[model samples]
Target: MSNKRGKGPMGFGGPMGGAVHGGAKAKDFKGSSKKLLNYLKPYRLSIIIVLIFAIGSAAFSIIGPKILGKATTKLFEGLVSKVSGTAGAGIDFEYIGRIIIILAVLYLISALFSFIQGYIMSGIAQKVSYNLRKEISIKINKLPLKYFDKLTHGEVLSRVTNDVDTVSNTLNQSLSQIFTSFTTLIGVLIMMLSISVSMTLVSVLILPLSAILISFVVKKSQRYFKEQQNFLGHVNGHVEEIYGGHNIMKAFNGEEKAVKEFNELNETLYNSAWKSQFLSGMMMPIMSFIGNIGYVLVSILGGYLAVKKTIEVGDIQSFIQYIRSFTQPISQAAQIANVLQSTAAATERVFEFLEEEEESDNLSTPVDINEIKGSVEFKNVHFGYNEDKIIINDFSSKIKPGQRIAIVGPTGAGKTTIVKLLMRFYELNSGEILLDNTNITSFKRSDLRKVFGMVLQDTWLFNGSIMDNIRYGRLDATDEEVLEAAKAAHVDHFIKTLPDGYNMELNEDASNVSQGQKQLLTIARAILADPKILILDEATSSVDTRTEVLIQKAMDNLMNGRTSFIIAHRLSTIKDADLILVMKDGDIIEQGNHKELLEKKGFYASLYNSQFENSEAS
Candidate 1:
């Protein structure tokens, strides 16, 4: 919890200056502070106890100088007596020893109380951070897909990681210090007043100067901190995007562009970071300088008062000590403005994310997937990512149970959007999709999703063993069942070729394997789940001809007796006697089996012929 970084007693982040965690600046301090208090409400009693210990500790610490002053005065008296050679003027070593003992006791008690307060504060800080992260994790599941579409994974991670960390560090380092510093300030003020009112005023004079210096620095630095945090998020997002697709970027000769963009973001982060750190770093030295001036003034005044016999030498010493203690807390109190500002900024980001619209409630009656057939019907479907423009306008379709429905279209022709609508990933503006005579909305989102298994153009695999990744589809599947699914999907052969076989661990992005092989692993997962309805969105688009043939054969086996919808790119892939919907500009331009559409010589024929001609030319 102590933010002390170097040899100085005063810690920069603790009391002397603002901490630049994530380089964030708070825009709305009051609002953020108010909301943050809501989280602390649960720990109100613990906070009060921390305050009590803090006050007790400072109170005991304040008494130490005073008690030591008494010892000093006694020792001085004894020295003067010895110099004058008075009969009963010998040094009262006994009394001085007793005073030293009492002072030691007071300091020991203060330290004990301080330690307890710090321990309690640490627990409170950690609990608050834990609760915050837990809520964010739950919120992620509830947020609608549109929210994720607009924001990068790194941007969200910034809020969850950097922002949360900022809050945690601030609470750990500053929260108890704020209370202790203010208590010390007040207790030291009282102690100084008791020693000499004039000396207290002299020490107090430096406060306004210290306040002005700290205010100026904090005002200059806060905006930079905010800029630093924003740029950091941008930098993180940029890195995540480039790293995720680094192979493709290298293939396309996009490394230069990626580097250029990264440099721009990094440079911006540097500019703001250095300025914020430099300004915050100035806080302690400036306050220390002002404190020194006050120290000089108090020393001179206290010396004068002692010489005039108005106050004892011991009193002067004690008052000077109190001044040192007093100014530190004042310096800390001044720096608190900056600390609160950073806190507010981080809290605002966290609250903003928490306040985003969650996915619509799945409060409708839950339909059991096992009770229904796989009949799917799209009735007058009208939808678009944007509300003002309708892309899939008045699109209607009906598919019989256990049929393989292939949807073919050019790029940007709404091929994938249709599947998204079917799974309720995006709600329709005005339309209804029924599965087995019941509106899809009638089922809970979880229940509806469980009935359908998906294998998309983009394959996602977690960092786990090959067996574990395959078993992800059906978590309870036995090892034998997992191997069976892999064999059915034609991935068992390649998996066996690996040194670790099914036990081989995948890397972070599963980049240890080829993209085509990754697709096969996903197919094995889908085969294992064995859902009633299947959605394959260009699942084989990334594989080679031979791999595609194997995948197609495995897919054919998987599609048997199951309702399957395939979004295909290769025209030759869907040549069998199954329904084929050729889409253009969000509308179904052609429909029928391969032979029927080819005989018609319509849009489907043209699309088919174009692909054949292009393939032949290549």
Candidate 2:
């Protein structure tokens, strides 16, 4: 999103001496700079060192103006006295020279201190960003599956990358400078008040007005910057979506439409940025104009007051010098206001994400595998994806240990939803799911899910070796065990034929493999898991006849001692199921063994008859 602050129109995030947001004044940052400052508490010594450097830098600034004032006063007074032929009109160039040398030494020391300050500030920024990045990474791991489903990958990606960088950049570019600006302003004001307090008052009369103008500009910049950031998020989301679905777009001939949408989003971002830039760019020049006006007022009035013997010429000169000193800080404060506001907006987004509720992690008291009996049941379950619509209405079923059950249903019939609910992906609206005669909710979510092995319709694989993918089922499994599982899934033969076999890298999503091989790999993973419950969904749909025969054999072996649930569109695959549940519109229309359901000539009968006739025709 747009981080457009007060700067002239240029490139985005490039090195162009960038500016900051307007809405968030240093005083009005939406998030706690105090919270960010807490990081310094851990390195108080470093903070003290940097503070000393900052003090030295401002001290030199104060001395530099004083030196120039002294030299000017000595030289001018001497020349005026010489013209008047007055006694004690002789110059003290040596003394003036000495004071000027002192100022030079102070400046040289200031440079050294400035270097040290830069180094320490950079260290602090990186250290703070490191901590934030680590904390965010850990927080992501704790989040539930649903959070990812709701927020786009780009949104989260921006948080981890763009947000972290903003925090770091604020520290690196602005942190010490902010300190210097503030201290210099304070020191200059203190000096100004000491010499011709009246002239100092005159010089500062326009100060409040300048501040108000800057504040107004900042407010406008902040509003635009906020909009810019939102548009940036849109741009990021669009690019990610298009890049992710490039192949899909090519297949559907939708490239032009995608590009059109992206261009539109880019145009919006550009407009928001340009307006924010225009407003922030006014801050410095406007403040400089006010400062120049202050100087002009002091020049006229201070000179008049000096002639009237109310103030010395030297005092008038000192007031003018201090005016120059204080103006820089005034301008800097304006820029800080802009920068701080934009950072706050970004911080708001980051912290908002961090505060989201994470999934509960609790392990129910350990269930000894030897003591557990396999039993599962669903009682009048009512479920929905959202509160507004129910997908599963009073669905009921019973599954005994070691029973082979098949669920048959068409699209939108809540077939997949049942499996998801059984796994507790989403809680049911109303009803109880029981495992071993105990309400499933009473079991820990992790512990409950640990009892099952699933092979889904779409296979998922990490970009890793074949052996590593299988080992994902059981991280502790040895290479030999992974090979054994592959053999069980009828995948070992294919693996042996490959150049690198199990050692080969699987590209993202395992796209290097055919659909049939991908299914086999998923079966291999499930085989390695070796859980007490097996769930298959569209398991053999992609495989050819020979491979399907081998997969069915492997599944039969896998189901020998475990409770299994299979959902298949291919009815012939489920003829041997111990029980077949015919589901339509979330209701169980009929259920029985293949032969018994056929004899009844009901919903299951018609479905079976049509499938059998189709097979015969083929």
Candidate 3:
């Protein structure tokens, strides 16, 4: 259905609408609707059955007006006969009672069919929603990290929540409504025409005016509805960003700025919402005006036809009832078309997300994790986040099993990118990384990742008990094992100080614990994993100076025989490394033991001196 003819009686084009909200706009109604129909194909049998019941219900209800007219006609004839003093002057109470009973039975049947159709349609709608959401959840795991880097968390979440809700709600309420309205309209039209074509003409004449009014209101309101949806996404994004970064924002005195930004987005959403609602609300009143006019004309024409003996009194009454029934369905059908357009808009977003390219899992002969040694070699690697710019150009490194390596570099010197590449978190532009004489790409991603344990500068802890968080590193680990791992990480003492010990529940924001405590907990998690290789990216950066000494001792014990790579800003922490690699820009400028680099008086020597000099100055 086209937008012009598809608007709801409220002038709203879809399930919900507002003005000038930013985001994706509704696409071509016909194209989106066609795609949405594909999802319904699986439920075609149930949908057909629902439609049959809906039609049966509407047909039964349509028959009532005709039967009711008989009661009215019989009463009128009896009154006239009594006045004329004729035989059979009194009312035929038995016949009138029978007609009333038949009308009641027809209405009861109609109601029952309506209920059945609704019940079945509700099931179909819920199933479709469940399936769509499940596909989206699975799709999230397949998407590359770059996709997330480009889209905000709230934007992706909105597609799953708001957009899916819109589609589900429309299907549940509007789909069967459309079927019933269409059947009722057709049945009423036929009945009205059978009574008197002249009275039917009066009713038909008002349809053009209704069409014009509905078309105009829909065109004006649809744009606002699309805007409202977009603004809603923006509002959600703003709120998510602020909430996640609440601490940073407060530390930098950014609360006011965040509030201001939120208010701007909120205001835009409000404007679009109210305007769309106002315009849509106009549709019902306009439709009613036209309907009333049609009713007046139908009544006048029916009275004229009766006087001319062109139609019976009861038939005229039935025609009037049919007119009332006919107009209601006509309006409902028009509104349903608008609802369908809105549903298509929502369904398209879901399909678009599902259609995104997934990471390839084509390595059928993946190396087993148990077979991998701690040895790693990067052979003339080339990489970049984007194709046009090279960030890690001609990089090469080799580390043997049980070796300790430290990577030291200024910001933006590709220090982290090297670790990312080694883990195969990103695909290489050229060259390869190998572990235990086998290329990393020769193993499944899961198997390759299992061989390494990482403790990053930023500690992440979910809302769970301390024991639960530690066990996250290895799901099958026992409580005793978890406690042992915490002891090995030197975090057991602090954990024991808590009233609930390991059983304490963390709040949603996990703000109850200090930063140093969170860092220690993450270290405990890595200890539990007991991976073949360990990567520490400033793992103790958040700890106090006293705690740092203990953590360093714990990490040294943990890395006793494992190939370990440490990336640290504190030059003192890596002074005992087996080898230190100093990077500048995207290239390694100096690589050797700390003493060898200091004696060489090269880039590493200068960098090491600068840090201490800055600390002493401060």
Candidate 4:
């Protein structure tokens, strides 16, 4: 099944869509922010302690300069007094050195604590990301097949890789930076007030303008941020389509069309990316300009105050340095605000999947089929992929234990759909399908699928050893059992000649293996299961005529004691069936054995004769 086919054909307008009971989720950035904070609740104490250390670290870093300034001013004051003879003045250089050494010790303690806090916070962030990834992966497994039926492989992968990565980085980088910025701002403001409350007032006159600029930039950046994520989704969807259908494009001579379509999508992606980055990039410059204007105002104002002897020169100098520290952190904090918004958008998408409702099943236990009787019955079965497009209407059938049933149909006939219903992939809209007099709906889905083994036209294999691929049918099957199944499928001889024999690693999508070989492996897997109900869906379509003959013999042996349902276009292959059903337009129009259907001289007879003549001609 290709992932790009969203929701399935039943989605009507969309290709391969899934159940769309709910529309797109409506989530706000505020909600995402709250959820992220909740994830940190377990480490609140550590977070607070880290914050305290961060404040102390920045404060101590600022203290060295203040202490040096005070000591220098006192030394100069004593020199002036000594020269003017106003009083006997003495300054102790020793005491100044001791004070400087004490300040150094304080800064060292702060640095040590800062390092420890950084390591612990980062550890918490990484742990959170790891837990989230594991939780999402487990949730994905529990999701119903219908959910996967609608979503593309690349879109889901983006949720895992892109969304999770964004969230992880925000926790590790933005959250911590936010803490440091706020603390630095508060600490610097307090120091400024202590130095001169009046001067502090003058310095922050430009702050309102800075705040407004930051808010405007952030508000505008929000839309572009959202558009960027949406465009990224489109890009991922496009890439998945192109890669999966590269061969199809070449076959249809659509390479130029594909390139043009892809380029248009890429261009939209580029525009969105530029808009998002451009808006964020403006934050630094706008804030920088405002801070510089504030600095100039404070410098000129402080000089006036100093000349009037209202504040000391050293105090004005210290005040300006504090303002510098404060502005840098304030501007950085604004940028963190913008980054967090973008991260929240991604978080919202991720949690939307987490919150999605999956299909529900009430059956707790199923009849274990150690030996299935293979009696299948469709009792007044009514089914449809959608309400508007009914595939089977009042369909009924009964297959006696160990009987062989052949279903013949045109392209839109419900033959293949019958098999899907029999397996209970999609529940019938208003009827029951019974197996050996028991309703299949009463059985667990896993147990129901286990009763049958299938070989389909599309041959799929994993990137593992041949033994592992075959052993997928019955996980407990041993090496000898696998080899036996392969032998029965007429694939063992080829496997033995390959490099490393059955241990050879398959390549991407098993592309290195031949199409016939891939089909043989799936058939071997089905054989290893030794199921009660066997379905061969054009099983030998890819093989040459010689291999087809061999495969038919192998399939006959495999289906000897099982109830078999075969869907094939090749009419000659089903001549020995006990019951032959010819269907058209979702309804069975003709029936009976080969000889009886020929006598009816109806749709079945014409189809049989035409195919008979084609065989004769060949």
On lDDT, the candidate that comes out on top is 1
What's each prediction's clash count? 1, 8, 8, 10
Assess each prediction's global lDDT (C-alpha) against the native: 0.85, 0.80, 0.82, 0.76
Lowest summed lDDT across 10 adjacent residues in model 1 is found at 1-10
Q: Give candidate 4's total backbone clashes.
A: 10
lDDT of 2 by residue, 76-171 (tens): 888888999998787888978898788888889888888998899889889977887887899997787667878767568767777777778878
Ten contiguous residues with the weakest lDDT in model 2? 6-15
TM-score of 2: 0.82
For every model shown, what is its TM-score relative to the native structure?
Answer: 0.92, 0.82, 0.91, 0.84
TM-score of 4: 0.84
- Top model by TM-score, which number? 1
70-114, model 4: which lDDT tens digit per residue?
765667666767778875566767777887788779779868867
lDDT per residue (tens digit) for residues 139-228 in model 1: 999887978988767568767776777688778878888888888888888888888999887777778888888888777876776667
Better of 2 and 4 by lDDT: 2
lDDT of 4 at 53: 71
Lowest lDDT block of 10, candidate 3? 1-10
- Order the candidate numbers by TM-score, best to worst: 1, 3, 4, 2
Give the C-alpha miss distance for residue 385 in model 4, angstroms.
Answer: 2.9
> Sorted by lDDT, highest first, which candidate order results?
1, 3, 2, 4
